[model samples]
Target: MNAIHNTYWLLAAAAALILIGIGSSLLARRFGAPLLLVFLVVGMLAGIDGPGGIRFDDVAGAYRIGSFALAVILFDGGLRTRRESFRGVFAPTLLLATVGVVVTAALTGLAAQWLLGLGLVQALLLGSVVASTDAAAVFFLLRAGGLQLRSRVGATLEIESSANDPVAVLLTTLLAEFLAAPSGIEGSELLRELALQFGIGALGGALGGFAIAAALRTLPLSGGLAALFLGTAALFVFGATGSLHGSGFLAVYVAGVIVGNRNVPGFANLLSVFDAGTWLCQIVMFLVLGLLATPHTLGDALWPALGIAAFLMLVGRPLAVALCLVPFRYGKREIGFIAWVGLRGAVGIFLASIPMLMKLPNAELIFNVAFVVVLASLLVQGWTLGLAARLLDVALPHRDRAVRRVELDLPGSLEREMVGYAVAPGATILIGTALPGWARLVMVVRNGEIHMPDVAGSLSSGDYAYLLAPPGRVYRLDWLFAPPDEAIEAEREMFGEFSFDADVRLADVADFYALPIRAKDAPLTLAEHFARRYEHTIEVGDRVRLGPVSLIARELDDDGVRKVGLKLERLGNVLVRRPWLARLLPQRFVAR
Candidate 1:
């Protein structure tokens, strides 16, 4: 009876903690507090050091929970990552994940040696523990804060965060092993292990992802069952890879990328379920780590930990980033933003547990110091992320509000999905904006009445319209249903006053705007000029300056750029160059 009562009490307490963490997310967002920090604080408050006074010291259990949670978080991150994002960033991202991690660890290890008075191996281990940027922290803060960063910058950060964990884990484990028995390991064996970890992890992930995606497509699973199957299959891959002595974190993340990019059944269901699952995992992981920490013992190490954290944020991360990115010709602003966003979170704490698991000398000191560093990071770096992005000009200048979109898998086809959208008052669709040829409206619900596309005639405000579109292409239809007042205004300001077909010749634009162009290049179309300027894929919002005018890619398709918008760099300069155009053109065009 006592055991049963104790079990019940434990369950209730656990439930209460999770609920508090979930509820605290709202408050965190309101106050611009990092959600992970809030969760950690909640767990701390419930610990022996704080008011709740719950005595918990389960290091192994916390490590286990954290491993599982991080796996899920990485898998989800991979799933959400688009293949297109890797277009031009693959090389630089890889370097950042591998070479960059090493440099950061080296620099930070030096700081730890000086401040904490730790030996060489121990200092490096400490540095390795906190080396990788946490995927959960990066993903959560970016999404929750509603930041839409530039494509290159965002992709590099996301992919780097997901990919670098394996390196950090390997380094931490290797150092821990060396600390445990310095005589047993050889240099050649270390190299072999590194090769095996990455090679096998990548190969296993690709194979496993393909297998899961095939199963999802071939099996008759649906709804919740399909989502369940996906989660379990991913875990199986993770465990299998780890059992084979490969990096399970890398394997699982890669598998997610493959599976997510493939057209599998119940994709929408999988996304919805995994989104919730990752959130739960993050909260649970942070809470467990928090409970494992002995806050009272941290006072001795607080100042040194703070110094290390400051050095990491100011010197270590920035120096490493600049070295890795300068060869790639990344702009100063892009490098600065990426360096600042190298936030340490759950991964560091989780890695610190390894030393505890190994029973290393000064393991407690490492754990406490790591805890302080993570706390300081989340408090300072997380809070200022949005502000830094804005000041650094890495964030794209556009409203990133949520669109009311619902996606349902088509019964017989993987190529198409049934997507529904709520028509806003000033939607472009209401003004007869045509959707892409690939999209076809099939149904409309207006004021509680269901009508076929033909019966509905035209979509009106307050109508719910459903269209059949390729699974991943539904986002292209968003602008048609979006309330365009703000979006249109913003686009006009950013792009230009007017748009012209990309096929328009540079000579014609130069003649009209009274701008000089090289005679050899004058015959080239705007699209051709953009193609020449950018060796990689040219996305919308890409701009090219032409004397006092700027040409922006307004619209693009598979064929190439479809439309180009032109903006005068300085209205006064343009007027001075072509004085008569002030009287000939409307005030809108002349005033820029």
Candidate 2:
């Protein structure tokens, strides 16, 4: 009977947790506080002191669950990273993760010692634990909330947050062990341990990621299944490295970069799953931590906690960022922005639990300090991150004139066509051109004139215009207008070998492929007819052919079939090509 009751209770608890998670996620958007905070509050409500009255005082279980959840979350985060973003930011990010963490920890430790009268060990623990920024926190807040910034600035923060946590966790664990040992390890030994952790973690991560990428390229995994298998492999790497006394976090993060950069099959769908899983892990981890807290214990340490929190926020974080960024030539505003946005959440709380579990002297005090710090970070730094970005003048301006790709069929074409090109400023060819061929503008909407080009006409960044061109020559256009290196690659679509600056005219385009079929004054599908005359297979799934361009297939939806939308290019057939070295090496890899 007792066992039966236990089973029923467990089932009920699971059901309640599900309902709470769904409700909290929905409420999170309405409330300015992050969704994880809501989950924490909800978990607290379900605890002994709240309506649920469930006594969940299982610290060991909590720790086990938290560790597993965090490992998976970190691994997933790594697998979805873009390796190129790390190029310029790597040196600075590394310094921030290493020297910056040490400096911040030391500064905060001193402050804690002076302000709160904490012992040296306790102060160091507090500092080290809170030193690293929370990956889950920043990732969710900045990206999911649509917080935008300049490419470099956004890249720096994202990379730093993702890169630094493993080091902090290492510090926390090592420090905790040292403090508890009857004969504490020597400082030299501690340094050695730190070096080993980083060495193994970084090397393992790089090797693991490369191995996974190589395997995926050579392996025969299907798209959907490949995504799942890749995620699992990342987790395996993290666990395997950590179990060998190495930094698994580093391994996982590095692995993610490798996978993220490569053209893996079904990566988009996998990214979706990884992001969703990360949120779930964060909610559960934070909520469990919140529920485990006793209000009475927290209340006792409140004043000191507040003091420590204030010191970490106002003094420790800013100083660290400023010092680390100086060598990178970051401007004042960029430095200031990074400084202000060092929001802490679950990581600190989880670290505090380490001391509590070990029954360290003043464990409750540490927990209270951690809790206060977490609250302050969320309320102060997290909320102000966006405003700070704007104030610093580092926010990237949003431009709506960027090119958009759309597929249009001419009046009576049995086949399809692909078009791609960019509108250049002061384009001579557009000045004396005709309606379908001369207009050059693909976005002007009146009279089916997409857009008009002028001497001062602003070219939309990353635009791929859809026009009817020959199938074999579209690649020439893509080669022409590929953005200056480092621009985000736009999604690919089908057009006759879509590229930039080809001589395919708009009317010629419609006439060639039979586009603009919906309107009364539609042009002829000459491109489509050309495809039929050549005995080429120009089906729905096939690529469109301009004289030299080709567009690939993307989707078929309710509105219409969507292919790679490219525009007719106006330049004569001069294929702008690069040298072999330029093609082989990324911009960042070149020696100074």
By TM-score, who's the top model here?
1
Task: Estimate the TM-score of every prediction.
Answer: 0.82, 0.68
lDDT by residue (85-158, candidate 2, tens digit) is 57678899888878888888899888778777888888898888788887777777787667766556777887
Measured on C-alpha atoms, candidate 2 has an lDDT of 0.64
Where does model 1 exceed 4 Å of error?
A: 400-583, 586-592
For lDDT, the strongest prediction is: 1
The global C-alpha lDDT for each of the candidates, from Candidate 1 onward, is: 0.86, 0.64
Q: Candidate 2, TM-score vs. the true structure?
A: 0.68
Model 2: runs farther than 4 Å from truth?
Answer: 1-5, 222-224, 398-592
Model 1, position 394: C-alpha lDDT score: 68
